[model samples]
Target: MNGDDELSLLSWMYGHDHDDPVPAPRLGQGYVELSGGPLDGSLLDVTSWTEDEIATGAVLMTVLGQTGPDGQARYAARPGDPGRWDWSGDAV
Candidate 1:
């Protein structure tokens, strides 16, 4: 896909998880543009990200999926741990 198309895809992915409480870093506030696409370019797909946003995206993607890099779910609870049962195995 073209660059704009790719950026659009990234933006959509970034914005997909409405239930995730982890807020994406504010773009202009946390990062400055050196050179690239439109200043208002969407930071969703995977490409159009500031460094902080990319880190956030990685976390969001992992949480939305069942298992993360270590093969564990986004959240886990130890047996006998207080409030342990509240975690869903599949819920992002």
Candidate 2:
């Protein structure tokens, strides 16, 4: 038939068809807000974070404007605050 019809057929065959035209979900959907640091008020995407990392209460992130030589910043997640991570200090 038409080109659009053919394309739709191919998409369905390849499992690329979607019932809704809404955009797909973005990467790092789940995020933690930085409380204190150079990245204060910034959101760190932790969607890919593992359970162990979350349980450890610590997340080391490398970001811009870091005065440290290594450019790594350390943060600690507080209890009852899953959406926020407090800056502890520089990692290196």
Candidate 3:
């Protein structure tokens, strides 16, 4: 009927019972961060992406300063940094 009880009920409804506190989510687990260029400091969700797909990298769209109206900017993942993607220049 109180906070803990309510949380437990919610957890049960979600199909998981956690006696221990759930650890905070980290980057690359459910999402990856974008670094450098136009898409700097952005987070891309990878929850549904396969390992191969992620490793091959992604072409993310952005409307940052470089990309004007109706424009598209693309970024790619750099080597040795799976947790982050770097800008690869603007797209047509």
Candidate 4:
């Protein structure tokens, strides 16, 4: 992906609107980026009323979490008894 695409993805991840549609992802430039995800870039919606969804808000479905260092987990909301979130990156 190019720089612009990455920035757009970042904006989507941060769940904020940008005057330029796909705004740059700076800590305080105008967006609040969340930390964690599927890593596949599914672009989970951790916040409500995303700029793109302002017309039609969305409901939370799958969830993702990033723990210390390499620790990471995913809680997918799927059919019948979703699997528990597991993180193998935690150090003992």
Please, what is the TM-score per model? 0.18, 0.55, 0.57, 0.19
Candidate 3 residue pairs that clash:
none
Worst 10 residues of 2 by lDDT: 7-16
Which one wins on TM-score? Answer: 3
**lDDT string, candidate 3, 1-92, tens digits:** 79843433332111113353643333345655666666565556677889989887765544454657545556566787777677777767
Cα deviation of 15, candidate 2, in Å: 31
Report the error of model 1 at residue 11, Å: 4.1
Model 4's lDDT to the true fold? Answer: 0.35
Q: Considering TM-score, which of the candidate structures 2 and 3 is the better prediction for this target? A: 3
lDDT, each prediction: 0.33, 0.56, 0.56, 0.35
Clash count for each candidate, listed in order shown: 6, 0, 0, 0
| lDDT digits (tens) for residues 1-92 of candidate 4 | 89945755554442334355544443433222222343333333333434444322222222333344444443233233221112222222
RMSD (Cα, Å) for all candidates, in order, is 15.4, 13.9, 11.8, 13.9
Better of 2 and 4 by TM-score: 2
What is the Cα-based lDDT of residue 8 in candidate 4?
Answer: 51
Positional deviation of residue 10's Cα in model 3 after best superposition, in angstroms: 26
Ranked candidates (TM-score, high to low): 3, 2, 4, 1
- Give a tens-digit lDDT track for model 2, residues 23-83: 3333436656666766565555567779778656554544443565446667768678876
For residue 79, what is the lDDT in candidate 1?
40
Pairs of residues clashing in candidate 2: none
